[model samples]
Target: MGDGDRRLTVNGSLRSVPANPPRSLLDVLRYDLGLTGTKYGCGEGRCGACTVLLDGVPVNACQIPVDEVGDRSITTVEGLASRGELNAVQQAFAELGAFQCGFCTPGMIVRATALLRDDPSPSETEIRAALNGNLCRCCGYPRIVRAVERASEIGRSGGGRP
Candidate 1:
């Protein structure tokens, strides 16, 4: 096997690509696997538009090296839905109009999913803290917060599942 040939498992699919060793996970995900749901708002890690779950933890895809991902399970917005059913957070976002431009919706939903998984009932402050890394330029944070809260309530009441 050549040095450039690397194996990456993304969104439950395994793929082999001729990627440079230093290539970021964002590049591999977008260019190689065609998972464009993860956006590239800022090359740096400040913006969470490029966020994806590496082993269920939100991380900046632009800052993660493909080679370093190894056997970790990567989950992007594409994986949030299953069999034509949207996840709870996604449905909440859609119902509440949590996003304006939709550029940051994927990352926000991903982070909110993680938050809900960790805390079934999170206070507004806890939700804000959980989503601190993700930024929305459209200034839709209030609705986003409301969406997360609603999702939590729906989840607890067993109404979040599709």
Candidate 2:
């Protein structure tokens, strides 16, 4: 609770990273905590490759300073699994081929997870709007949208894992 002592929960675990210079949450997650699934792209936060959940909402980790993390719970891509099994969204992404290079997969999955958590049955337009922030260079936009639709169905069948 003193200066430079900041604590936050990530992937269901608590982390106490330093806040002296206030490193980006992305750096804390990847460098300090060894969670590399959250990728680094367009450090400006426009690419959404460093997306993660902050208190159940999707955010660009690169845009958030570690000191600002405070006590919020951050969910990385690694936290998507439940009991060692892939969650509905993850499975949908895999089965539906939502990604090609896979570099942006983690962020896409995390953002989609948040979207599904908020609305399990989002329409195509809703899915597109939700994913507007995330970009994939492989041009797999259609597949990505299909994957979201599949995840929605799976979630409706009680297959989603927070």
Say which candidate scores most in lDDT. Answer: 2
Give candidate 1 misplaced runs (Cα > 4 Å): 1-4
Error of 1 at 5 (Å): 2.4
lDDT of 2 by residue, 15-103 (tens): 77776676899998999889999999999989999999999999999999887777888999999897889999899998887888998
Tens-digit per-residue lDDT, 1-162, candidate 1 = 467687777778877887665789998889877899999999899989999999999999999988789889999999988888888899899899899999999999999998998889999999999999999999899999999999998788897652
Error of 2 at 77 (Å): 0.4
Model 2 worst lDDT run, 10 consecutive residues: 13-22
- Candidate 2 backbone collisions, by pair: none
